[model samples]
Target: MPLFRSPTRCIPVALSVTLSLAVLSTTVAAQGVRTADPRASLKGGVKDAQQAIKHLELVSSTPKVEGWFNPRDLGDFGFANSDLAFQKHLVFQGGWHGWQAWDISDPKAPKRRAAVVCQGGQGDPSVYGNLLFVSVEDGGGRLDCGTQGVSDTVSAARFMGVRIFDISNLDAPKQIAAVQTCRGSHTHTLVTDPKDKANVYVYVQGTGGVRSPNELAGCVRSPDDTSTALFRIEVIKVPLASPQDAKVVNMPRIFADASGKVAGLWKGGDHGRGTQNSDRTDQCHDITAYPDIGLAAGACSGNGILLDISNPANPKRIDEVIDPNFAYWHSATFSNDGQTVLFTDEWGGGTQARCRATDKPEWGADAIFTLDVNRKLKPAGSYKLPAAQGSTENCVAHNGSLIPVPGRDIMAQAWYQGGISVFDFTNPAKPQEIAYFDRGPIDPSRITLAGFWSVYWYNGHLIGSEIARGLDIFTLQPSEFLSKNEIDAAKLITRDELNAQLQTKIVWPAHFSVARAYVDQLQRDKGLSESRISAVRGALDAAEQSSGGPRRTALTALATSLVQDVAASGDAVKVRLLSGVVRELAK
Candidate 1:
């Protein structure tokens, strides 16, 4: 399968970033600060609302397919869109019903390939080659993909776990396995062991209550029951040769202490005066596994944890941290280098207006931490949408992914009705917003529960999974904070598959645009002398116009000069990166 935009990716183009940046900067660690900023007050409607965008352009706005939604009640909880996963040119979108495979081969206009309708509140989906797994936690879920749900308190017809489907035939997928757990899977991470090829593992997070003994056979209602499905995560092993035999292999107590107390983490309570009461560290809401780095970040109820996953089936807790301002640790994202982690606090449960004029900036925001040589997480900084939203709008930090900008830690995040915010966290202590795209509320009279649940950068577009509206695709435009060279360089780093929670290493090819992106960064921050910057750009432009031999010779010379500038430049790390890219291009 050829790439979507590879035919002319290396062509010569204009690259400029000389404008002074007015980054959206503010100390997000402050509390009890408010102002009548009057944001999100534009015109509103279900489909036709005023949009506020900065350094971003919407390429397409696709609505839900026929029979998939009810227009009369757009905010219907039973039909809300959830998370997303990508493989090749297809995006599998999960919802309350089931999952839909979207053909983004032509990204401007996505087409629906196939659909599955199973009655579950959140069918969080993950894809690995021809295998597709959808989570089932709602008690109404059934074995068959039936629209009518099960009403019995305990019935044999109910299905509550992870469902594996053979999606080799997208037109008619077949259920391969239904691995049951004490509590159903709210979300699961697809993890691959570097040393194992015959099987893959899934770290299942069951946040819902446990099932009855009659329904699942191993679940109890008592909170103090030793066998209760809490304070631990279920690990399921799926053999590639026989996926039908997938079952629970281990339930590691990732939240236990040195003495092996299952409930060793924080109990539900407030920290001090005027603080919010946090939930106990019983079940994890989400887990992000970076197999390439042998580490995983767990966003448990009351604590943010780090796990050593050298053994995929048996992950051990290595470290944990807590934030006084965080009410509930909802999700986690790691930097590309695996040196830092960003955790989100889903305050107000992501449905209330947590970004109001009187709300504290540190309440429902992102807490960033840097990892030391000992793998301990130290507080770095915090970031929140530095804007006030209407009371009727539901806004807070939700799901987001790191944009593959070379030499920078940039992210495009979702904030419910507050909109999508793209920020730069290269300096974790001073994360700043670079771009954003927001829409007015669905209805101004009352809350509509319509906003972007998550936004991710895939191939070259920022695709968003909106709760009320359908899919939205956007491309980051060049501005003072970002350059065309940097955006093009990011596009060079493509992936065959993307399960955002299961992060993989990002590798850029030996391309001239990659080198230019680094050069543009130096110019933006004044890291190098003006004369040196001009000379480097001229050399790159000249080399790009010449043939193979001349281009190599010119690039080699430029690389030698870059190596010398590293000692004198203000940003030694960026200079080193630029020199490395130039050397790779010469080779």
Candidate 2:
């Protein structure tokens, strides 16, 4: 659910009048009517209401882009907020009302498999094999999963923490354990050990208020109290063979200050040069763990820090950074190379229209950073949605994941009511939007606080969790910006399961598609002369058509010549990569 805030004052009569005008406009548009001047209808209204409606009816997209919207279940409450996890052809979507499992065997027409009704805010979920882990932070959550809700603060029926479920049978998921925490798990990251395959570790990041001592023993809220649990994150260890034994193994104070005061990190303040005031960093909002590289990035409230997770049980802070442009550190994503990190700022707590024309471009956007030779972070650049949204729409940079397009860093991101944006950031210094899908505000009369909560590329399609609408599926099509060969190359890289936070190195198969993808990128980036590119393409085509020894010899000769050309041009990276492809072709 969205962070609650006071409603804006408005006259009931004026709202009714505006709604009537909107209805009239929709009716007129439905009748295949066109006004003499389209801009005439948008002259005087409540902050571009007419223009917002026009955008809703006619959306912009790339050439062959197709999208499907799967509405929420009949009895779900509140808006959607959190990440999405996938297994095979199934998608698990979490909401404040509960979690739903959708069988996306036909992504164009997804069918709901199950709906589990459990009241929890920010029900972020992740899956591993047949196990599912959901974070529950709302105090109203009950142990029995009842709809009555909990009233007594100290009631034993109250349940807030991580809920584990056995999902072997999609139709009937059984709750196995509920690991309780001091602040309740707002979000959690799944970490696996290479040596210890017998168990999995979950780094629980809770951002809510602390539970009372009467409700949960030893939960102190005072910053002065060294024993306070508010400034630490919980690490839960779950035995693969016996998941019921899941329990908190460690509570590392990763936010501790120099004086050993865990609650004294990143005191909130404005950064003087008219920048936004920063939120106090008490706990992390999200953490992206690249276990393959033995590192993780934590997006704490006011600070972004890197961690050495060589020991999954006790992660140590390696470096920390602060940004004057960021108000709230919301989420983190790592580049495929693991050298760059992108952190999003949830300005206005994700409820206000921060993407309005008046908002600062860098305030609620992604701040890019690259690790120096010493493994310390250095500011690279920032990216925000280029399209301006109406004031009634709450838009800000939220959750997103990298699109595995072979040798590129492309991301499909969700920006609340700002709709979906797919952009290429391979050149971190100058990231640009390549494709987008946006609609008018959900309500023309006022703000509805609805849109995509998370959009991720899983399998071959882009799946998104819509806050008010439901599940959405999209596919990238060939356009001026993206080529068919590039799309095909991305499709070749598929996964059995996907969890956005757990970063994995993508390795495409050694096929002509992979080679062509690089060629397409080189053509787009203008890395080589057109005549040279044409010659290289001709050689590749001949090599692909030839058989056995002739094919190998042709590819080898072309590879050597291309390497020489690229080397002369001072592009050692491309030289080595093209050489490797030639070696594979020879094999």
Model 2 C-alpha lDDT per residue in residues 345-431, reported as the tens digit of each score: 888777778787666666688877788877787666678777767677878888899988877789989998887888877766677
TM-score of each predicted structure versus truth: 0.94, 0.88
Q: Tell me each candidate's RMSD, in Å, in order.
A: 8.3, 9.7
Q: How high is the lDDT of residue 342 in model 1? A: 91
| Stretches of candidate 2 exceeding 4 Å from the true structure | 4-82
Stretches > 4 Å off in candidate 1: 1-26, 29-38
Clashing pairs in 2: none
In terms of lDDT, model 1 sits at: 0.83
CA RMSD (A), model 2: 9.7
- Residue 304 lDDT in candidate 2: 83
